[model samples]
Target: MGSIDSYIFRTTLTSFAVVMASLTGVIWITQALRGIDLMTSQGQTILTFLGLTGLAVPVLILVIAPIALMIAVAHTLNRLATDSEIIVMNAAGLSPLRLFRPFVYATLVVSAIVILIGAYIAPDGLRRIARWDSEITADVLANVLQPGRFAQLEQNLTIRVRERQPGGLLVGVFIDDRRDPNDRVSIIADHGTVLKNSEGSFLVLEDGHLERFQAGQQEPALVAFSRYAFDMSKFSRARDVAYGIREHYLWELMWPDPNDPLLKQLPTQFRSEMHDRLLAPIYPFFFAAVTFAFLGLARTTRQSRNFSMIGAVLCAFVVRLAGFALSVIANQTPYVAGLQYLLLVIAIAVSVWLIRRNVVIEPPARLVDALNALTASLSRLVRRPMPA
Candidate 1:
């Protein structure tokens, strides 16, 4: 590639990386917050919590990459136009299509990344997350049987142990169960141990006394036992992992097993997801074309490029929103999926035509004048001095 092409490509790619990271990090933090209970209540280590939450980053990148590419393309085009580089290139016999080549390369790179994540990495991450969650929830002894801390295993149920012995034995165990509205059961045990077998999980308590208090009666019934088995199966989750449509690999989606229970149940969802992943890579190119069509023109500073930038952003937003809407509709009407391809085809065709013809897109005269008037009003309001 020529120096100019390399320069444009580098700048655009750098911008894309920066924007993609910023957006993904911010959104990932918000998503991670929702699962903070992994560390806060589930007794998971910080690294484990972060690793589990970090598995979601690939999916976020799959969604954010296209938007970041669009923004990067817009930034590069606006910079070229602002410095009259586009005009200079035009004067030097560089056609609009030639000037657009660098952006196309950058878009291709981003699209490949999106495709990789969407087709395999993202779904793999989701599946691993499901597996991790199952393992974490099913290991109830590790998560709930802490010494000296009352662990809220579930709503209205609490377990606490004064000490834990070397061999997985719990000492001075206390259980409070108020799940039933009429009866509140409390058990104090001298020692306990968790047992998991083919039947289910159970907390076997030795030398325990059980006290039952009914809502209506002031007196409480008590029972003493040498050995009591408290049902802990409810607190333990099933180890079986069930994956959603989004968790399927691309090949699995493409050539799904007919007997797969989830596919058999939500066949429409499978179809929609397959289409979405297939079309994921094309969006970056579409976004780049749309952005360049609006912001690639060489106009004087007096022309005000703000409206052009806004138009580009709004057009990109509308196109993406339409794609999302169509994807949703495709779940119900299978044929509707074709409309997304048609939409992108038409948009990219129009954008390419406009770029080739050097067509400039501008707002209507009336809208411009109204915006100018509103800006003046706002300026006056800001400049107006406060009364003493």
Candidate 2:
């Protein structure tokens, strides 16, 4: 690679990395806040929240990488054109295809990253997060260990222990089960024990009265019992969740088990998910094609390429949105998979043709004129005096 190639490649790669991380961090924080209730209501620690949220980063990276590469390519090309560096190279007999080689190299690198995250990192992260959430929810000690405070174990269940003895006995146990909309239960016992079995944990309440209230009426029906086994599963249901298509590993998706009931139920959905992951690496280069297709052969004048940049952004947006739609449609109709690949191939072909021809996108003067007229009318409306 020449000095110019090295310079453009390095600058674009750095810009892509920075943009990707910034966008991922911002989106991750927005997503992580949804899990804050785990700590605020469910008595989870700050570290636990961070751990669960951190596991989602690989998924975020998968979504952010291609857009970042496109932005980086467009930004670097615009800067070069504005500084007349591209013109200098053009005068020295550098072809548009030659100028785009560095960006293609960068795209190759970014594509590898996308593939790695889509195939391995994201699925593994999701699996770990599922396990973490299950363990936290099923932990009887964390949910009900406090001696004098009522802990809201989840959305509908609450428990309070007056005292916890040294030998794993709970005294003055109070449990409120409001999970059922039709029947709300309140159980108070002299003492209780927490026991775990193959199915789940159970809170064995001794010498307690069960108060059950119907949905509409407030009056309660009380029944006394020597021993009552209140299934702890009702309080928290963080058991082994049936793994969905999104949660399956790449290999699992590619070679689905026909014996598996979930796979048998929705084969196309699983196949769509697999293809989505497999196609992750291709779109980055396709985006690079669309990006450079707009601004590849730099203009000799000092005129702004704002319109060209907007055109490139719109093109990229349309292609990506179409891909996303195909991903959804492919779940039901697998033939959308062919349409997705076709769309990408068309974009790539047009991009290469434009680069070879050195085509320059011009501003849409009619749209610009319309926008200007609208703004002028708005300005006049704002400045006009009020009627007496």
Candidate 3:
């Protein structure tokens, strides 16, 4: 490659990297802060929260890369234009397409990275987070029975144990089952082990006495046994309590069982989530296109350039918001599914326009001049006049 080609390539690549990193840090920090409350409620540690939240960085980058690219491209070209660098290159007969070849290469590399993240890395991280939540819930529920205290497992069932250990072993275990009006059963065990089998989970007791009470009789009947078993599987279901849609993956969400009472009937969110995953990989391309638009409009002042970059970013976000709103509305009407493709096409058109208009040393002078005049007029209206 020639010196000018190498120089433009290096400058644009450096700008893209710096911009992407800064935005990723900002987005991750903001999301982590907002999610801290939910994490705490789930008993997730700070490290786990950070790691789980960090998984979302790839998705964020996928969204933000195009914006950064647009800003960087705009800034790089604008600076070159302001310094008369573009004029030098143009005078030497360097075409705009030739100059943008390196940039196109740079954008393709970024797009590939975004695709890998959205498709594989992001999904894997989300799955890990769901599993972590499942394990934590199980641990909390299994530890519900405390030593030396009468802990009520349910409205009619009270359990008191002197000591508890791993492998479902319990010492001085007592269960008071008042589940029936006609008959009541009380059991005390010297030593017990929780056993999970096909019949369901049960606590096998050793050196225990079982007492049965009948509604018609005043006295209770007691029977002693060397080993007795008490069913404990009913408590196991509580450990599997899922928070909501966030707990399941695409497949799990789609074919949920008819008997799964906890699963809400909102199939829209699941469909939306599936669409979101499929659509996430393409966001980088849109961002890149938008970046081109921003870069196409160049200015002399750094502050002015910053303002322009912010404006482009905001506009992109507005487009995203509109698409999301449309997706929600579409769930109510099946015909709205077409809007997703419409959003994608719009993004592609914007990118193409940005490239076509800004690929050269600068965009057409008349268009730039008109935008400047409009902006100046808008600024004047918003500005307060000084007292005469």
Candidate 4:
């Protein structure tokens, strides 16, 4: 590569990295906030909370890479134009296609990243998260029982612990069971530990007393025992991990097992996900073409570049939104999936044709005039004096 090509490639990739990290961090923080219950309610440590939340980063990158590439391309092109470098290159007989070569290289790199994450890493992260969530649900004693908080294990059943010590020791354990209408039972234990075996989960209480208040009788029965087992198997959730279509690997989606239950139930969803993953890498190329078509030309300072930038961004937005809408519609109408590919093809083809022919894209004159008039009216309203 030549010096100019190297410079453009490096600048665009650097910009892409910065934009990608910034956007991912902001979005990931919002997503992580939703899972704060893992720490606050479940009594998990901060490290565990972050580890579970960080698993979502690969998925976020899959969505953000194409947009970042477009932004980086636009920034590099605008910078070159602002410095009159594009004009100088054009004067030196550099064609639009030659100038776009560096952007294509950068886009390819971003596309590879998207492909890698979408195919394997993102799906694996989702699967791991699902498995971890299932484990947490099945281990009800550790997750649901919080120190000093009365945890409602089920309707009409409550349990509380005064304190939870290290190595899963519970102090001052109390349980109230009103599940049976005929007899209300309450048990107070000095201390207990959760025991899970092949049979089921049991709370082995030591030095506890059980009181049974019969509904028909006036006197209640009290019994004290040195050791008692409270069956807690019902509180544990199902351990079977049911992964969704988005959690499956790319190859699994491409050729799904005919006997798979999820596939048998939602065939269209499998098809939609397969197409979405297949098309993930191509978006960066389409975005780069669209951005270059609008802002790649060498324009003088007298001409407004802001409109071109806006047009490029709007076009990218429309294309991505259309693709997403098509993918969703494909879940119901299988035939709609093909439109995603067609949209990308048409958009990229048109963009490349414009670039080759040096056709500068601009908003319609009427729209620009209307916006200017609206701005003037708003300015006048703001500047008008208040009536006393």
lDDT comparing candidate 1 with the true structure: 0.90
Better of 1 and 2 by lDDT: 1
Ranking of all candidate structures by their TM-score, best first: 4, 1, 2, 3
User: Number of backbone collisions per candidate, in order?
Assistant: 0, 0, 4, 0
lDDT of each: 0.90, 0.86, 0.69, 0.91
CA RMSD (A), model 2:
7.5
Instruction: For each candidate, give its TM-score against the true structure.
Output: 0.81, 0.76, 0.58, 0.85
Question: Candidate 2's residue-wise lDDT over 131-196, tens digit each?
Answer: 887888667665555779888877988889998775558899988989888999998999988788
How many Å off is the CA of 286 in candidate 4?
1.3
> How does candidate 1 fare on TM-score?
0.81
lDDT for each residue of candidate 3 in 84-125, tens digit (9 for 90 to 100): 776577567665546666676667777777666655666566
Q: Write the per-residue lDDT of candidate 4 for residues 1-388, one digit (tens) a residue.
A: 9999999999999999999999999999999999998876676678878988999999999899998998999999989998999999999999998999999999999999998899999999999999988877777777888889899988989999998776668889999999999989999999999898998889999998999999999988999989999999887756888889989999999989999899999999899999999999999999999999999987788778888888888899999999999988999999999999999999999999999998877778898899999999999999999999
Model 1 misses residue 127 by how many Å? 0.6
Task: Give the TM-score (vs. native) of candidate 3.
Answer: 0.58
Q: Report the Cα RMSD per candidate.
A: 5.9, 7.5, 7.8, 3.8
Candidate 4 residues lying further than 4 Å off, grouped into runs, are 146-158, 162-169, 176-186, 191-238, 364-388
User: On a 0 to 100 scale, what is the lDDT of residue 44 in model 1?
Assistant: 72
Among the numbered candidates, top lDDT falls to 4
